[model samples]
Target: MIVFLAALLMILGLIGRMVYLMVFDAEYYQKKAEDLHERERKIKAARGEIVDTNGTVLATNRTVCTISVIHSQIKEPEVVIKKLSKCLGMEEAEVRKRVEKVSSMERIKTNVDKETGDKIREMELAGVKVDEDFKRYYPYNELASKVIGFTGGDNQGIIGLEVRYEDYLKGSNGRILTTTDARGIELEGVAEDRVEPVAGKTLQISMDYNIQMYAQQMAEKVMEEKQADKVAILLMNPQNGEILAMVNVPEFDLNEPFTLNQDQEISEKSKEALNQMWRNGCINDTYEPGSTFKIITASACLEERVVSLSDTFSCPGYRIVEDRKIRCHKVGGHGAETFVQGIQNSCNPVFIDIGLRLGTGRFCDYFEQFGLLGKTGVDLPGEAATIMHKEENIGQVELATMSFGQSFQVTPIQMAATVSALINGGKRVTPHFGVRILDKDKETVRELKYDDGKHIVSEETSRTMQALLESVVSEGSGKNAKIEGYHIGGKTATSQTLPRSANKYISSFIGFAPAGNPQILGMCVIYNPQGVYYGGTIAAPVIRDIFDNIFPYLGIEKDVEMQYTN
Candidate 1:
């Protein structure tokens, strides 16, 4: 009787458990069964567009396709290989290798043209799969390649602004889920489930397309004419610090960033060469500013009252500073001249004397004050910091060289930003490119903000410096930069590279327009030009030619009263 009772209890417990599973756990088990037959594939989201301030598209995406193969679904291996190889223009052997691989899915090729992908899709060969994807396209090919950067096979940012703002530039990927049978074939009469991908936000930058084109044209012309190693041009608004254009000559094609732009054997092209080609010399590299640095020295001196514009000094070609004899550019010198003439002549002796008057303590103080000694905090990547002698290590000789823009190194962007400060009402602005971010509907998602700038010098000193730089273009070394009816102001630099004996020089010029109330500021740097490598001669003229075209296009009217004088 006891055995029979135990058997009955066991049967009753089994019945209760079956009822619970059928009723309470039915949904969960059903989902698990459905999941076993479901196959999921990913859909790539389209990357955002990059536009200029004028709404001109600089970097955009083109529809492409990714060709993949499902190993289990491929029944006719030889037929699949033949069709895929012919359609994809790939080797049959290669297609066969991937088709025979024991994997869920294998990618044959990505970035295939849409037309070709559509052709493959129409074949409806069981194993072959084509999905829409995006490939970054630069309409201008090589324009601003380094700054806009490029993406990798995974569609992730590689460098430049693309990588810098990756979060905003990349989008969320979606999925395509389909029901499949045991044979890995799509189940009949079943509809596929697709989750649409979300596209990235549009990035708007301060770069002006027209200005950039003109600047690039001028840079190419100068580089070809001078046979220089390279040339870089940067343009910005001194008042607001918006970089209008940045040109690095011999720019690599954004589409073919891996290929070297120079004439060299494929095997000889090293990674370093590619890096150098992509490098934006204007911010990534540093050099002695030479006479252009004189702008900083003069501004500091004037602010400190160490020297007045009318203060007179004698320059018999050189100055003796702590046993070191520093020679001026003009060996015969200007004999006796006021401080204004000294600046125009770029006299080393006059600046050295004034630097001595300011003293080492004051000179270092100004160096720190001028925003030199640090990065410009530009939006671009790989910005180099100014290389300087430590304040405590600076001596009479170091101070003298620093005064005339030597014995230290600063990136071109730093020089441009600091000079902008000296001329733009004493506020040191951060040089940047990003302007705003927008959604697909063109609504403002976020307006980018940068440092509003710190007050470095007084407004009075800024005005005085502006006038002094205007004299540099009007009557001094930078005369070649003068436009016929524009009140242009600038400083010229001819700095020698290291080892002194190498004799290689970088010719550069930093200039602004309508000097009284500065607007556009630009700098042209020509590295290692052949003969006639003076900044005033080669570099200054490049800016003049660019401004001549860009100024008119930008609707900057000429100053009717400002006349050119020989």
Candidate 2:
């Protein structure tokens, strides 16, 4: 009787436990069971398209295929390996290794062409699964390659605008769920469940396709003709900070960013070469602005009332400060010239005098106030800051050299932005490319916002500087940049590179059109040209050529009457 009762109690306990599992833990166990039979495959989402202001697609996507394999489902292993190896252009050994692996799902290859992928699909090879994917494609290939950037194998942005705005450019991956048997074989007559991916938002930038193309052609033409180490051109609207075109010559192919353009084998050093090749010199690299920086100095002096356009000055071609005698570009010296003439001649002595008169304290004040001491806060990444001497470290010699756009370094974009502020009604504008974001339906999602410009100079000072710079292009050293019927204001710079003994030099020119009310501001920087390293002779003409072509294309009408005189 006791044994029977004990057995009955044990049976009841077992029954109670069974009841608890069925009622209380049913959902947990049900999910576990579902997971065991469900085979999950990821579906890659399409990246957003990058278009210019005119809706010209600069970066888009091309449909490709990702070929994966389920170990248990694959029959005729040798046949599968052979066909995949040939179709995917991979080694048979590599294909076999992945196919033979005992994994539930393994990616055999990705980015297979649509034609080949369709062919494999028609073969109806068991265990082989082909899913469509998107690959970033640059329609113009090398055009604006550095600015547009490229993606990695994972479809993530690696550099340029691609990386800078990754969150807006990358999409959410989806999943494909299939019911399978214990052996990982898909069960027949069961429809696969799919979670569709959401594509990234479209990016519309301020870059104009035509302007970028024209500028790139001009940059390439000049680089090849001059045999320059590199050439960079930046064009923007001074009134607003919208970048129209930015060209860094030797631009890599956006489709083949990792491969070098040169005919050389890949090596460990190739990584460094690739980094160098990917560099956008206009913003990434910094150099002495030479006379282009004089624009800043003149603006500062004029703003502080330290110098006037009519201020009399004498340049014997060189100025002696403290223990240093810095020679001017014109060794004979510009003698008995007004401040306006000194700027036109780009006489180092005249600027040195004004710099000293402004005093180191005021000079540093203007430097910091002009936004030179910090980044320009551009939307792009890796923008370099100005390299200037510490305030306390700036002695008379330092101050003198800094006066004529020497002894300090700044990026091409920095100078362009600052000069824009100086000439464009004293409002300091932020240079930018990205303008708006759009959804897949082309509906406006968000318009990019920028910091409001701060007043850096008085309007009177800005107007005076504008008229003075116009004279420079019309009658001064920047005469090469002068165009017919246009009031072009500009400055020329020929700065020697570091280790002055090496004799390497950078020639640069910064200019703007319709000087009375400037619209476009452009700068050309040519590094270490083979010969004729004068900014006025080489750099100035490049801008002229680009403007000449772009002006009409942009529908900017030329003034019927001449605005400035020689």
Per residue, candidate 1 scores C-alpha lDDT tens digits across 1-566 of 99999999999999999988899999998887777788899998889999999999998999999999988788788888998899889898888888899876799988899999999899888888999999998899889887888888788888888998889989899999999876667787999999999999999999999899888988999899999999999999998899999999989899888864333555544877778888988889999999998999999999999899889999899888889999999988779999999888888899999999999998888889888978899998889998988888999999998889999999999999999999888999999999999999878899999997688998888888888889989999999999998899999989899989999999999999878878899999999999999999999998999888888777888886543211
lDDT measured at residue 248 in model 1 versus the true structure, 0 to 100: 90
Q: Pairing residues by index, what is the TM-score of model 2?
A: 0.93
Candidate 2's C-alpha runs over 4 A off are 1-34, 260-268, 560-566
| Tens-digit per-residue lDDT, 424-536, candidate 2 | 88999999999999998888899999875799999888888888998999999999998897788899999999999999999999999888778899999999998789999
**TM-score for candidate 1:** 0.91
Who wins the lDDT comparison?
A: 2
Which candidate leads in TM-score? 2
Estimate the TM-score of every prediction: 0.91, 0.93
Deviation (Å) of 187 in candidate 1? 3.8
Least accurate 10 contiguous residues by lDDT in model 1: 260-269
Clash count of each predicted structure: 0, 2
